[model samples]
Target: MALPPVLELVAPHDARPPQEHPCATGVLPIRRISVSIVSLVLLALAAGFGGGLLGAWMRATPPAAESTPPAAVEDTQTRIRAAVDRVLPNIVLIVAETATGQSLGSGVVVSQSGNIATAAHVIRGATRIEVVLANGDRRPARLVGEDSPFSDVAVLAVAPQGLRQVAFGASAALRPGDIVLAIGADRGLYGAGGAATMGIISATDRILPRSGVNLEDLLQIDAAINSGDSGGALVNLSGEFVGMITSVIRDEGSERSAVVGVGFAQSSDSLRPVVAELIRAGRYPRPRIGIERPDEQHVEITADVANQRRLPVPNGALIVAPAPNSPAVRAGIVAGDIVLGVNGAKVDFDFPMVNLLKRLPRGSRVDLAVLRGGRTLTVSMTAEDQ
Candidate 1:
């Protein structure tokens, strides 16, 4: 038994103590368990909050059908067409034949008694005139009278039976940016009638320069005006005639190119006074002032009983040159005398010649105050009509 030497056995407690269960008390294990529970709770709350936010977003947005409404629309074409229908019957296409053929323009029936108004250049030197109605009836027209080359306006007469007269509107009150519509025979051809255009009044009181006459009181607009639109009506949206389309503008040397948005019209004011005179008189008499140009500065002198000082001048127009048998000469006014006054008022070389001439009536006597060399003198003279 001693030979085996006996296997020695260690006690459980004394043997290399069993390796401790290392994971049981370490920080890593407890931390991991706590993290797992927290992650599950966080995910549940996140899901609930996301669902609430999405529901709120959907509730706040408006539906497409509830946001948009039906709109009320208007027919502009119907209104313009109605205006044209009411006005076209009152418009006429004017044709005037000259040696070079015919000039085309437009006119309006201004009177139930057959009077028509148009631009003078349209009917200038016309051998004959023709007027065409909207219904295609053409008739011979007569130029009753014209007020030119002072004003480029003329009056024509058409048969009154079937003519439709347009109602005149007040052009004096028109302001800038007011919408205007114009109608005219855009082309020169007969039965072509008129076309309608729309724009606004751009300016007023424009001065137009032409041969022989200074055209004033012009109505400027931006409507499209063509060659044959002269004398056509520029009407308001209310369908009333506001002005007459009379001219179109183009740049110099550009003949074939039609311009855009520029036109002018003769105002109804200028037409009224002109038309009234035409209806009254067969012609407008040109006004004139009677006077003759003096070759040298002339002085007039006259004698006054009231002159106590020995002044050289009193009264009378003195001529520096002997006007042969003229009123100044016949009035005993000699050369080298100073003209002090006419009709009791003093006159001198510094006085306006126009005013002196204006003050002296033709076939009237003028008293002049004058000074000759050293002697004051007064003279009575009769003015001669020029």
Candidate 2:
């Protein structure tokens, strides 16, 4: 079987944590992040240390009536500095110990009551998980829950120590040219503290295939996301987190896995509801249609794919198998069947099969337009609960 596109996460192959060493144990004085000169002035202004330059600063500033906000008073460079400082304390390194090896990644604290969000793959097969805060504080984390495999999000819990949480911003309002920061742990091999790099939101609404499912509605950036940067924060200029750094699309032509200014993050707009459900009920009740898409099947039915596969339509989800005794199996959605629509709506790249299923209300009858042997059949079935 052919493999999917290389959307690589912080895997054990690229970097592995020590077998017995706990995260951030006895690490003295982590390296300081280098700040731009503009940022230093912004920091000084915030700390009231710029009082001596008050005349110069006020002369350079616009009238309060015309200013947008505090962020508007400063330039992008200085605002980025202040934003990085505001969120730096919330970034943490995560260590997930599995039977074979360990997965090392970064995480962002989402609540002062100790709710942390990280990449689902970071803790997928973890037997034990530990989090090291940016201040060199180590805390044991308990897996609260995870979003469905279609979205790469997971939540963890720790003792409530008044941790500063990153504020969630509206990712829907972001544009392609907006400035964003990718915050992660340091690269000293120990992976203890926080660091960040600058970039712009290159694009949005991207999709990447992983395992047998597709991670949809992703935010694409040209940020320098690297190994150990998984589950890190992708924050906007105002220090509000808009997405979570998840994976990097590597250069296929290179001999080694190389990041070529392409990275992907799960948008906060899509994951906010999932996070709420997880925190409320310990899990997100993702609609279970029990679909088993054939490995490496293209989500979109292109013109060439339509002609090559000899399908009547151009786009739909191709299901190769339905799980035994599940709703799909009971509904007669069999192998070699292509899902054309759900609830009288077309299923295509814009509104994918997963998105369709996710929109279906639980306990409501789901009418699926199944393409079997080139004949369309409306199969009615209720989706299963979590």
Candidate 3:
């Protein structure tokens, strides 16, 4: 018996044998198959091109975004460095010798005439003052004038030769977050040179009570204030002097603690007038009310007396004693009277009578609202220079 017809599989490209009889008349559709294969090849090529283009676009786009930030950072750093360099020469290390000891501080040259601005407390009670320049030149300095009791500012005079003056900037234009540089001899007492620390203006128009006087219109900063940094220059990014380093507040618990980023600078706007006056005269002209409170205890006693008398305002600047034949006596403000206000502005703990008198010009007429014997009386008076 003949074996059953065996089935054989053939590749698509392989030719079929002519001896085949059944269904050989039907030819394979080669053209359609070739067209489908061509279409698939083109599609694969298009997909490859699209993927390469997407990769190139992604690489190019991210590079620009990544590079821009670093470039800006570098530019800013360069600017700050340049600013520090430009202003460094104007900064001087001050040494004051008194009967007590030698004290080191910092100052900024403000004029070609060898005028230097520094904190008054630095040179307080100084018998002989010397200024060490950036190039290590030591020059003798004389006390020109000072406003230490009220503003803690001072001016010194030296030889005009070999001094670089700093450009002054308006402190009123400064806002919070403005970049500032503090340049001083942080360790100058130990013979270190001038160093710079960077920070931003944390606040403006701040008032701080210091040594029985209120430091008003202060620029609060977050910069580090070292031991010898008082009387140093606080400059803007443009290398212009904006403020003078006055004091630093430290944390106190059991003993003295190192508090970082809490410092105060006297604004240049406030200093300008004081410095001008100091330069013109030997001291800042202060307006006087010719009455004394002596201390806080005395003020409190006067307030208590006012309350007992049922005065309209129970708290104010209480006069412990009035000067004989002075403005207070002329205005009929006796020792028992309490000054309530001046020129419609209330005088209290925040706005004290002393601060008001300081702001008033000499010979300026002011209305003092006084409380006496349970009555509110307004008295007109003229401020006298003290």
Candidate 4:
């Protein structure tokens, strides 16, 4: 981008080049000088680029990306290395031998019991499935299940072995600028299966509707996600898997359709339900509990809110109202009641009722800890279909 022209001194009588400025102020249209380096400095002619390198560098609003300090960059490298070392063992190359050709991609073990989470399109219409572990050990895998095309997530099952489950990081807490690493096999099930690339989250809650695929609540990242990167782990600096790399944006402007450029991931926060249901029921369901949570505040449990309500807990979903003849109403829950837990899982600002509902199957029973008038009570109800 071009920089705006620098403000120059104008002669009182007529405009002349800055080099001809008469050491006297009488021939000038004055602008505020931030600093006079020296009285002699102003007395000399302002030689444009030849002698004003410092002034050019100090120009306001230069089109420069934010730069990281050397020390901070070194620290980031250290963190990336630690995250990769911890997560690499969980990333595996999935080779789905379809009737047409071999479909290769990456997959992350979601459970210690040998359930793997990968992109549904990666293993679509497979005749035989094979999982190549990080150490190059091959294991026969079976098609466990897949979610809706909108989710693009599939689950595979193999015999239980010594495998690591990725520590899931809360995507609900992710910010746009958070540093992340994309670990996957980019066109190299033989060599690139464990490759890692680092980038920042470009955006969150992105919706992409293109070419018959409609996905929602995606994490758009600036990382390189190539052909085989689908279903790979998107790890945070904390060495936690925060997202699953799903699709790459490659328009006609792409370098031969290679989209290692901009990519999207299904947020782990949004995956808890999809992954859980695919493992249990082989599909995703729109589960509803008929309780409305107030969407007013990002942080619902501020110190001020806690003090004002005189609530016993620091974090919870304050029930605005329960739908009439709904599960919450049937469970005796009402407005002014705070839901503190879901089936023994604490309900905080981070893991609120919304996420809890998504993680539960539609027909599952719910145990909620409700705080009403300073007393905690237990309530139970079956989750009805939405």
Model 3 Cα lDDT, one tens digit per residue, 1-386: 35578786765566675586444657547886699899999999999999999999998775543456878889888889988998899988999999999888999898898999999989988999999888778999999998755678999999989888888899999999998999986746555459999999999999987522477889999988888888899999888889999888877563435665598999999988887777778687776656633353125323565568554565576666677787778878777677788888877666666676667767788788888787889999887764
Report the error of model 1 at residue 36, Å.
35
User: Residue 290 in model 1: shift from native, Å?
Assistant: 13
Report the lDDT of model 3 for residue 257.
56
Return the candidate ranking by TM-score, descending.
Answer: 3, 2, 4, 1
The global C-alpha lDDT for each of the candidates, from Candidate 1 onward, is 0.69, 0.81, 0.81, 0.79
Q: Which is better, 1 or 3, measured by lDDT?
A: 3
lDDT, model 3: 0.81
Which RMSD does model 2 reach against the true structure? Answer: 20.8
Q: Which portions of model 3 miss their true places by more than 4 Å?
A: 1-68, 98-102, 252-259, 289-346, 366-381
Candidate 3 vs candidate 4: the lDDT winner is 3
Where does candidate 2 clash, by residue pair? none
Candidate 3: minimum summed lDDT over ten consecutive residues — where?
Answer: 292-301
Task: Kindly list the per-residue Cα lDDT of model 1 for residues 1-386, writing each as its tens digit.
Answer: 13456576857665686797667756467777799889989988998999899899899987767533333123445566677777777778898999989898888788888888888888988999998877778888999888654466788997888887887778888889987788886654644567888888899898674421246788899988877888788887667777878788776555455565478988877677777667567454431111223333342222442264344445334455655676556656566665555455545434433345444544666555545676766666665432
Clashes of each: 33, 0, 0, 0
Error of 1 at 381 (Å): 19
For model 2, the run of ten residues with the poorest summed lDDT: 26-35
The true-structure Cα RMSD of candidate 1 reads: 26.1
